[model samples]
Target: MKTVVIGFLGSILDSGGGPGRWEKWRPSVSICQHDDLVIDRFEMLHSRGHIRLAEQLRTDIASVSPETKVNLHVCDPANPWDFQEVYGCLHEFARQYPFDLERERYLIHITTGTHVAQICMFLLTEARYFPAVLLQTSPPRKQGSGDAGAYSLIDLDLSRYNQIGARFAREKQESTEFLKSGIKTRNAAFNQMIARIERVAVRSKAPLMLNGPTGAGKSTLARRIYELKKSRHQIQGEFVEVNCATLRGDAALSTLFGHVKGAFTGALSDRAGLLRKAHGGVVFLDEIGELGIDEQTMLLKAIEEKRFSPMGSDKEVESDFQLIAGTNRDLRLAVAEGKFRDDLLARINLWVFELPALRDRREDVEPNIDYELDRFARDNDVTVRFNAEARKEYQRFATSPAAVWSGNFRELSASIMRMATLAEGGRITTDVVEDEIERLQSTWRPKPSQSNLESLLPAKALAEIDLFDRLQLDVVIEMCRSCATMAEAGRKLFAASRTRRRAVNDSDRLKKYLARFNLDWAALKH
Candidate 1:
């Protein structure tokens, strides 16, 4: 197989001068001298300063080995010692470098470049950006020795070494733990989900869409991803975050894409906007489904082209950023209803991950309770311990099917904080847990007057239907009670869906839906 050697040129003048010069040895020259190593091509990478030295070394190598080919490549790194710049230069170089991995072997000569350059080469090789093995050259044993130095091939495919492979596996586990924020999650699904997110966070720059109920930790998880990526050196800029639900009209456009002076009524100064602020970093758009169509259109263009014009400005600005969007709404349904843009939804739906709500992950309640308690202790600087009875009571109620944590973690955090605040002598007693549980239950349940209508229907009829169908019925009943006429309730209930129909029959559809439950509008009105 043909072998290609890629390396930088060190100062050839440093190789002690000797008569007939076969006595002196250079790493690039010595590596070629090895009897067992056969190289068809040597790619010598040199800076502008090292051109003469590189040429002299090339002549010396060619004189000794007439058949071997020497190809000189110029690489100028802005800073040889700067890891990021060197890595970027090499990374770009590798991206464009032509490789025939199937027919030939490639070797990276790590002995000649700066340590930073060497490390970058190693990383690129490890990441398979540069599909090559490392070749390290050693100096001769003695000054007067007739022998040239040694050359050893470093194969980074860890699977060849069992112990190194084990270490790599352990490191992956540690990385996954860090991404998880050190929460010892119990659910298999949640653990697998976290692992998947870890992989996506490290490898992908495309927009990540997180969809879940309110307070399901979407915002917290997005921030965690930003921290994880930053720690991994994948991102360098600051994490720019904003909730789209709070942005409206001109404010949304101005806040996201910035605004030129005199753009709007109160546009007094030019703003850099969140996109520009997030350049070389991550931008998290929370409750993205709440964004208006105009905002979505601008976001779509910005995400694809990395360029957008500010409000009332013809000038386009650029910001290279990674995107992570979080929303509680079903974007697919939103797109179908014309409430969200189809193209924008399609783009973000590439890496969609749905976080289960607290109610869905009942098994995790015990761990989350411990997590919240520990967090409360750390935040308040006061050590608070839950009594055995109190802890058990809290877990029992939290995991119960009746426990509807409507606000999810937001509600749970407040509950723990409240309990910690009320705890006497640094101990949360069973009574404290019971009081919080009752308070949460009261908050979760609908008002007695509003929900009295659920009792109006026969219990047997509701019991005959499944929970899902029962919920749909409950919503319809609530709307009927609130609206003055059946037609008005129908219009509000299916407003978006009705727009797609050639002929609208809202009141009839509502009557038919109610009829399936053995109830009529006339009976309900009476």
Candidate 2:
């Protein structure tokens, strides 16, 4: 197999006085002198002006290593420092050069070019333009020491370095685990979501919107993202959290964008609000869809410009922060209703992650139970664990279809805390588990109006519908009952279809579907 070394002819470094040139360590010549690194061929690139120098270096290389063949190629960029021209020239050369990977190995010599040229070589090699490794040669430490200098090979292929690739995989796993709060969650979808969130949390400073049902850990995940960024030194400030649902009217504006003295009748002094307080850090706006339109406008400005005018103050205060917005309500529906600014939604919708409800991820319930118990132990200094039979019994009930888990992780955490508190010694026995199950069942029990479809439809009309149609209608009716408007309910029901056919009116489509059953949105709500 042949070893080929491709490099630029360094006009200055490769030049030397006659006869005394052999004493001086020249990279182009010294490289061939290495007995171990047998170079079968040297492809030296040179400018038109360096023809003489190129020939001289070629001869010197041949004299030192008679078995080596030296070939000179003309590749001159108008401006050597220009990255585009240099990269393009080299890229063209690489494209034209015949690379025989099976029979020969190639080394890109990076010691003899402009910084831009060196960088271009590295990029091309890394990109597999030249199926080669990078060879960096350095001059000898002492002058006139007759040293041949040193050469090191840098393999651009990461797979060749098993330890490095394994390290990266390990770090990614650790990051995903960190985002999950170290719980070994078995749900594949949730694990995949966390992995993507981990990547986005570390790599992006854009606003991240977490959409999930209430108590589905949106707030908890947002805080964990902040902690991860802080741990990686990606964030230098504090994590300021605000539940937007708790803010209203003047208080909402004053609480988020700050207010000066005498901003309102009750304003007595200047106050730096949550946005300003989150400068150089992260601000989590939980239940962001609850913010009024006016508050949304100001919040949008603060996010984009990193500055906003405080109440009763013309001057704008600056606060550079990363925004993580959480909401249970569908913001798109709110936008259609003129409740949320579309532009604001567009700005914060760059990275949207929807956390699934607990009922959707039953497989994760067992692991999360252990996590909750561990948390309880840390908080109260009392360790607790369920016995084998009790653990099985509790897990069975927790993962059962009957366990709605309306409050998601919050409900699960509370259940574990309750059982742990009532456990005998350190064991949560079947008796305690059964009591907890009954308590959960009672809390999850539905009211007559919500539980019974017969309450909404006459017995004769309900009996006429097929079971499948009845089941679907029940779900749609439930959605309508929960939503504030027909449009909102339609949006929830046809969310996926609306994405595919944007022109289709969701409310109209839903209305037509309801009419098939001799029903309307208004009647379903009643």
Candidate 3:
């Protein structure tokens, strides 16, 4: 197999000892004569302004070894220092070059080009825009007979060098930090999860499922994934997002699969739908568990087949796209209850990730507060600063056990927005923080009945639940209190769901629900 070298033609005019010196010492020719290296072919790129020197150098290089094939390309950039123009020119030049990695080993000669051009080559090769190793040539320090300048092949994969690898590890950390909205989280588990998600976003096109409660930043993360992919050129089309929960019946069908004119009662004109518009890119179906059964069925076909018939149309339209589905609901439960398709669940079930709710990740709240304030300032064109006391007070309450961030980051973000809005003279004083705290307290505080119910439980049981769990338990206990028997309570709580439930065990179901809180039906009702 032959090796191919790609590089620029260094000007022969720079060689000092007249024409013969040019023949003997042209760097392009010297590059070919490196004793340890064998020349197969050189894809030499030079500007049109240096055509004569390029041709002369090409001939001199060819004279060194007749077997070597030198293909010269005329690549010119208006301003070499301009990264955009230089990269663009080289990119076009590379597109024209025949690159066959299977049959030919490739090397990029980095010694002769301008620094900007060299950087562009490195960037392209690093990106696999040009898949090749770098070859750097150097002149001998002292004049010696039969001694030639050195050549060494450099691999920029970073894995080959400990220092470079460690540097890249830092880069990966920065990438993760970017995804986290600059939050320097102390949670090792959360950071590891973000790293995994980062790889999936950059490498895979398979459907991804993000399962988490609302305000857990699933949608925000989805948008971030799309942006990262776009910046990496992994995806080309626009990010089309849809809240499946907002769609219902015919609207859902038409909104997703699109519709031809007169497809339905309101179909006065043709619609392309969100899925078709997301061609060659990403489609984020948030709250996917809320999609109707029919829409789920159609979506499954589109995902598996990459083609689907539009509403009222026989012909199928193709949309090559990646899928990202997010839901706060338990889709497995929905599938079991026949509210969602099990097969669709299995398809997207391949890459399932759960984003932790904000309250559970309280350690992240402080940094997120700063992030939200920055965002609010950017959006509203107002610079709001929290005074030292206000900042300390807010952080104390936000992280305290008494804080019931039931709405998670969404609620937290709103609280910050409210404080920033009401802050006098762009300063969030302690008074503003107190007002926000009072507002949150009013919102999250349990009703008297719920508090009374908590008192009825054993101290050990009370210790088992924080605010959120107690809120849910309180609702269940209220139902139990209203019913005559445990079976009646289960019937009322489960409602018409029993028809879809696989096994009819109302008493057992209620018994297990009560057990979760360390309470029994007899203890609760009697």
Name the candidate that leads on lDDT: 2
Looking at model 3, residue 182 earns an lDDT score of 80
- RMSD (Å) per prediction: 10.3, 5.4, 13.4
**Model 2 alpha-carbon drift over 4 Å, by segment:** 11-25, 48-56, 59-63, 66-68, 100-104, 266-268, 446-526
Segments in model 1 whose C-alpha atoms lie over 4 Å from true places: 1-19, 26-135, 140-147, 150-157, 452-472, 475-526
Model 3 lDDT per residue over 177-255, tens place: 7788787776777888899998887889999988776777888888888888888898899899999989998999999
Candidates in order have lDDT scores of: 0.83, 0.89, 0.82
lDDT of 2 by residue, 1-526 (tens): 8999999988888888688877777888888978789999999999999999998988878888898999999999999999999999999999999999999999999999788889999999999998999999988998578788999999999778999989999998998898899999998999889999998999999999998778789888998999999999998999999999999999999999989999999999999998999999999999898899899889989998999999999999999999999987767757876778999999999999878878778999989998999999999898999999999999999999889787889999999999999998989999999999999899877675544467777789888899999888878887776554566678889988788984978788988998898876546644
Error of 2 at 503 (Å): 12
lDDT against true structure, model 2: 0.89
**Weakest ten-residue segment in model 3 by summed lDDT:** 12-21
Ordered by lDDT, highest first, the candidates read 2, 1, 3
Which scores better on lDDT, 1 or 3? 1
User: Against the correct fold, how does model 1 do in TM-score?
Assistant: 0.67
How close is every model to the real structure, measured as TM-score? 0.67, 0.83, 0.62
Q: Candidate 1: minimum summed lDDT over ten consecutive residues — where?
A: 11-20
Number of colliding residue pairs in model 2? 0
